[model samples]
Structure formats: structure tokens, C-alpha cells
Target: MLRFAPSPTGDMHTGNLRAAVFNYILAKQRNEKFLLRIEDTDTARNIEGKDKDIMFLLNLFGITWDNLVYQSHNFPRHRQLAEYLIQKGDAFYCYCTKEFLDQKRELAKANHQAFRYDDDWAELEKDKNPHPVVRLRAPKEQMGFHDAIKGDITFAPSEIDSFIILKEDGIPTYNFACAVDDMLYDIDFIVRGEDHVSNTPKQILIHQCLNYDKTMQFAHLPIILNEEGKKMSKRDNASSVQWLLDCGFLPQAIVNYLVLMGNKTPCEVFTLKECMEWFDITKIAKAPARFDIDKLKFLNREHFKRLNEQDLAVLLGYKDSAIGALAKLYLQEASTLNEIREKVDLIFAKKGLLLAQYKESAKTENAEILEFESQVKTLQDTLLTMLNQDCSKTEFDTFKSNAMQNSGLKGKAFFKPLRFLLTGLAHGPELSDLFPILRLYLKDIVRN
Candidate 1:
């Protein structure tokens, strides 16, 4: 089994989502059961409904799991396992107070040495204090694990301290709860970010103390960095999955870019379903992956192009295939759905003409600007009347031909004003190309 264990602390980060994607893909590829474990043991920071939000984001990217487990629901089991360690003599209650430990830590710091719990209080009588915390009697031996991505990571005995398992409040610490649950759930494969690499040895010690013999596979993906080469943080809005979606990025495009981030792919673009066919977790590079917004935009555009006209139109808030086609024309200049929607809205807006915006373009005399507006008004009236007629026999070329002849204007004078009238923009796709896609909406365009 493979598990994606995330805490409900805040908004899901892109790095977190990437781990989910990798885990989901690997689970599907191997035909193993996928699990979503909400590590909500740290009640201090968890946001209500944040767990649901994480699942919603996962669903948005088409990631499905076979099981859902919340760590808080297994507090009994966690406590039960902690007691089992005490009975086995692998752990004992420590009567040391916070001040005592703090002094020890300060002494070690003063001596320029790493502060490890000396386990001096292990021999003290439990009757010394009614409220005490449980601590594991960590074995002084080398601990190591073979990561699928980083490979052969080891830590010396000095690094593994006798850490706390149960707090004075009787709640399990993160490592204690995680190790017990992994053993209870029979999770054979674990995939998460590299930030947890240091915590691996502690969890390993817990498993060893509990006498759980099942081998667990781990893949600690490298950290994701921003353009500045710094670690991506929750404080950065761009790192939030919801922020990216609000900015008009398709979920498919987001997943595609994430899967392609630090791994070798046979092709540049693919869907989650397609990724399951060939994605190899072991092949991911150990180096940190950089988050590039421009690269994501490029991939978003590619995914946009793959959509059918009808589907693409629906995304732009339209039902008409012609409007969808018109939106595609805007793709030459607009890359996102929101950008294309702005262009399409201008076409059908009740009042989109920017006469003042046009006036700014008239760098000449005021009389020249007045003349240009007068000409535009004259042409607008003429086209509104002309388009209201049959106009069925007119193609783009012939339509412009007739408009030029009737307006008694040619070149920029004829084409420029007509372009502004039709699309409400000083620039866009060629009129010859735009006209055909927008043929059905010509009357509304002119009226707008």
C-alpha cells in the first residue's frame, strides 16, 4: 500500500500536491491501494475544513485514493502502542521538568556540542511525579534507510536521541503517532517530501522498539524552490494550489507541469491517466525542482489547445461553438482562460467601446480626433443597418470590401475603425481570420 499523509495546517502547498500526484500515480501504476492519511495529531495548528479542502484539491486534479484515514481518530491505538513499548522495557517515564531539560540544552549549547537527551531521569522512580512523559530508550546504533530517490541515507547513533513518545497531556508526538499508524495500517510504501528525511530515523526507532518487522519503502522527493532558488513557503501566495486555480490555471495543466517538474518524461504534455502508464518514482532527480510560472503558463496553453471547441467555449463561459472558436482566435495573444474571456466579453459587452482610449491614440490636432470619432460613428451606423439585412452572401473578404466601398474609406481609415467597432480593441487577430469565427455574432458585435 502507498499513503499520502498530509497535515491540515493551512492551504495545501504545490509541493504537497506534487507529492500527492507522485504517490497517486505510483499507486495506480502498481495496482496498489492508495491511502489519504490526514495527520491531524497536532491539534494546535489544524484548520477546520482544511482536510476537506485538501481532498477537494486532490479531486480537482483527478487524484483518487482507496482509503481515507484521520490520525486523530486513532488516538486510542497510538496510546495503546506507547504503553506496549513501556511494557516491553523499550521505553520509560521521564520525571524531568521543562526547566531541567532546557538547562541541559543550554549547557550543551554553551559547550558547542549537540544537545541529546542523556536519559539520566530514566532510572528515577515513577512515583517522583504523577505527571510524566514517556521516552523511548533509543538504541545506540547506526540507523539508515534506502530511499528510492536519494538512496542509502544513514545517521550516526549520536544523532538519534531518546525522544518523547507521549506528552504530559497524554497525547502522542508526531513520530510516535505516525509510526504506530503506519504499522497499524500496514503501509508498505511511503512517499513524501525530503523535509521528513531527518524524522525517518526517529520513526525507524519507534518501529524497532515496537518489534514491528514489516519493511517500509520510502521516497523522499526533493524540495521545490522558487525562482530565487529559495525553498517554497506557505507564506508565498504563488505556492498555494488554490491561488494557482484562482489565477486561471487548469487543474490538468497544473498536474501535468508538476509531474514533469523534476523527472524525465517521454513527451512534453500528458494527462494524469497517461502519466500512470509510464511514471517511475525511482527515476526522479535528487536535485531540487524549481517552480517556474512561465513554464507552467506554456504548459497551460498547450493543454488549452488540446480541448475541443465546445469544451473550451464552456471554460470561457459560453455555449456557442462559434464563441468558443472566437476565443481560440484570442489565444494567439491571450494565454489564460481569464485573458481570453476578457477578449470575448468585449465582443458581446453592452458598452465596450473606448472612445476616450481611442482619443489618446490621436497624437495630432483635436480636429483630427473629432474627425476620426465622427467617421467611426458614421461607419458604426452604416454597419449596424447593413448587418441587420440578409448579409448571408457575405464572406470576410467581401464583407470588408462592401464596408470599404460604402464608407468611402480605405487602408487604415477603413480597417482600423472597423476593427475597433467589431472587437473593441486596437489590436488582435487579423480581421480576415476573426470575421469567419465571429460571423454569426457580427450583428451583436456591431450593435455592441
Candidate 2:
């Protein structure tokens, strides 16, 4: 089983969603259980009602999880585990004040020494005060494990800190609480970012103390960084998921970009369905990746272009109410609501400069612009001639050759003016391509 444990902080940002997506895809690939656990133990930092937003966004992005769990609800279980560890001598207590710890840290820094709470005073502190902040004991031997992505990670056991497992408030610290919850939930595999590498051995010790039947596997995915190659956070402009959504980025495109980041894969694009087919934890890149918003934008544009018109309208927030006003303006002319919608949709889908601008510009007296529209009208008339005559390949070829000669123009000179007249752009889909859509307009003198 895999669990996506997010602390309810602010909104679920790009980094948050990326981690959740990876876990979701992994569980889906394996056909195993994927659970959502709200790690809201940090009472001060946890934002009220943020979990609903997180879950809602997850659903919007097509990421689903199994049982919804809350760590705050499991406080009693965590307390029981802390008590068990203390009784078994795996954890001990020391009543070290904040001032004392600060002084020790300063002295250690000055002396070029690793700062740690003096365990020699453990007994003395316990004797002076019955209630002490419990600390995990690290054995003086090298402890290590192989990471699924970043392989062969080993830490010196002597360098490990026997830090507070239970704080002065008697609340279990993050590391201790995480281990207890993982054990209770039967989470045998932990997939998280590589930043947690230093905390792994301590967690392993806790797992050992619990005497679980099966050993847990650790897979630390690489970090997602900013373009400057630093860790991305809410401070960064592109860090928020809302920014991407606002920029017209499809959710799948964002997920696809994140999935490939710090992971080796042959495919360029990955859909939610496709992700389940090709997910391989072993292929994840050990090297950290810089998050490129441009890549995300390109993927999103492609996704947007591929979406059907109905889906695109919903995604773009084009409600019928909004289009109703336009329908009334073109009521008599428009055959149905959909017909007017189709034109409005096609117009806005390309570029959203005013429709009257293009329509009026098409009838402009300027020679350059007039000549262009005239040439386009001529081409349309020629094509109509061919369609009506049932012209063979040779006849059409001769006509194209003669037309090309008389036009005395090629490339943009031919296409640019035509595009400018029809779509009010100096560039667009090819002239040959536009002929199909413009056939009716070409015949109708009113459109001209």
C-alpha cells in the first residue's frame, strides 16, 4: 500500500500535486491500495478546511486515493507507541531547556563538533524531573539502505542525531509520528522526496523497535527545482497549481511534465491511462530536475488543441449564459444556437480580437489588403470551378500552374494577405486549408 500524506498548509501547489500524482500512478500500476492521509500533526501550521481544497483539486486532476485518514485522529495510537518505546529502553527522556540546547549548539559549532543532547545527562535529567522529552537512541554503527530511485544511500550511524522523539509537550515529533502511523497502517513501502534521506535510519530504528514482521522499502524520488536549479517552493511564481490552471494548462499536461521530470522515459507525453501502463520506479532519475514552465505550456497547448470542442468550451469557461448575449445579436442570421456558437467558438479559439475588426478590414480600400482579399476570392472561385466541372488531376494541375504564374507571388505574399483578410492575422493555417472553411463566404457577396 502507498499513502500520500500531505500536511494541510496552504493550497496544494505544483510540488504537492507532483508528489501525489507519482504515488497515485505507482499504486495504480501495481494494482495496490493507495490511501490519502492528512498529516495535520503540526497544529500551528495546518490551515483549516484546506483538506477539502486538496481533495477537490486531486479529483479535478484525476488523482484518486483509497481510505482517507487523518493523523490527528490517531493521536492516541502514537502516544501508546511512544510509551512502549520508553518502556522498552529504545527511547529515553531528558528535560533539556531551549536555552540549554541553544548553548550546546553554539559551543559545538565553535569547537567543530556535531551538536547533540548529552546522553550522559539523560539519567541526571530524568532524576531531576520525572517528565522528560523522549529521544530515540542511535546505535554507533553505520546504518544504510538502497533507495529505489537514488541507489546505495548510506549514512554514518555516529553522525545520526538521537533527537527528541517526543517533545516537551509530550506530542510525538514528525519522524516518530510518521513511523508509528506507517506501522499501524501496514505501509510497507514509503515513497517520498530525497530530502528525507537523513531521517530514514531513525525511522528504520523505530520500525525495528516495533518488531514488524516485514521490512519496509524506501523509495526517495528526486526533488523538483526551479529554473535556477534550487528547490521550488510557494515563493516561486510558477510553484502554484492555480497559476498553471489560470494559464490554460490542462491538468494532465502538468502531471505528464512532472512524471517525466527526474525520471527517464522514452515517451514524450503521458496520459492518466498511459501512466499506469509505463510506470517504472527503477527508471526514475537520481539527478534532480529543474522545473521548466515552457515545457509544461507546450504540453498544455497540445492537450488543449486535441480536446473536443465541447470539452474545450467547459475548460475555457464559456458558459451558455455568456454566449446567449451574442446569440441575440446574430439571432435572425444564426440557424440555431449551436451554429452561432460554432462561429464564436472558432473565432475565439484562434484569436480574440474583435470580430468586426476582421470583417471591416476585409472590405478595406487599401490596395495591399484589397489585392490580398481579391486573390483569395479568385482562388476560391477557381476551386469552385474545378469542383463544378469535375476536373481531372491533369486539368486541376494546369489550373494550379496557371494560377500560381498569374499570382506572381509565393509563400507569405500569397498566404499572408489571404489570412489577414479572412482571420485578421498575417499568419494562420495554410491558404489551402482555409479554402474549405471559406467556400460559403467566398460565394456570398454579403460576407465580402
**Each prediction's Cα RMSD?**
2.5, 8.7
For candidate 1, lDDT tens digit of each residue in 1-448?
Answer: 8888899998889989999998888888778999999999888899999999999989989988899999989998888888988999888889887777788899999999988887876545455567889999876899999999999999998888888999888889999999888988888888889999998999989998888889999999999998888998877777999999988889999999999999999998999999888898988999999999988988888888888889988988889877877887777778777888888888775432476666766765588678768777878877887887766557988888878888887887887788888888879998888887667777777774
- With candidate 1 superimposed using the best TM-score fit, by how many Å does residue 76's alpha carbon deviate from the native? 0.4
lDDT for model 2, on a 0 to 1 scale? 0.69
Candidate 2: deviation at residue 273, Å? 1.4
Q: What TM-score would every model get versus the actual structure?
A: 0.93, 0.74
Number of the top TM-score candidate: 1
lDDT of each: 0.86, 0.69
Could you give me the TM-score of model 2 versus the true structure? 0.74
Model 2 stretches with alpha carbons more than 4 Å out: 123-131, 319-448
Clashing pairs in 1: none
Instruction: Give one digit per residue, the lDDT tens place, for model 2 in 1-448.
Output: 8888888988777767877887888788778898899998888898989999889889989988889999889888888888888899888777766666788899999999978666775655454565678887776778888888878878786677677888777777889888888888888678887888888888877888777656777788777789888988888878888777665567888888888777777788878778778788888878888998777766665554455555655543565333333323332333322434554454333222333455585776678655655666665444445445423333323544554555555665655543443444454444454343343333221123
Error of 2 at 185 (Å): 0.8
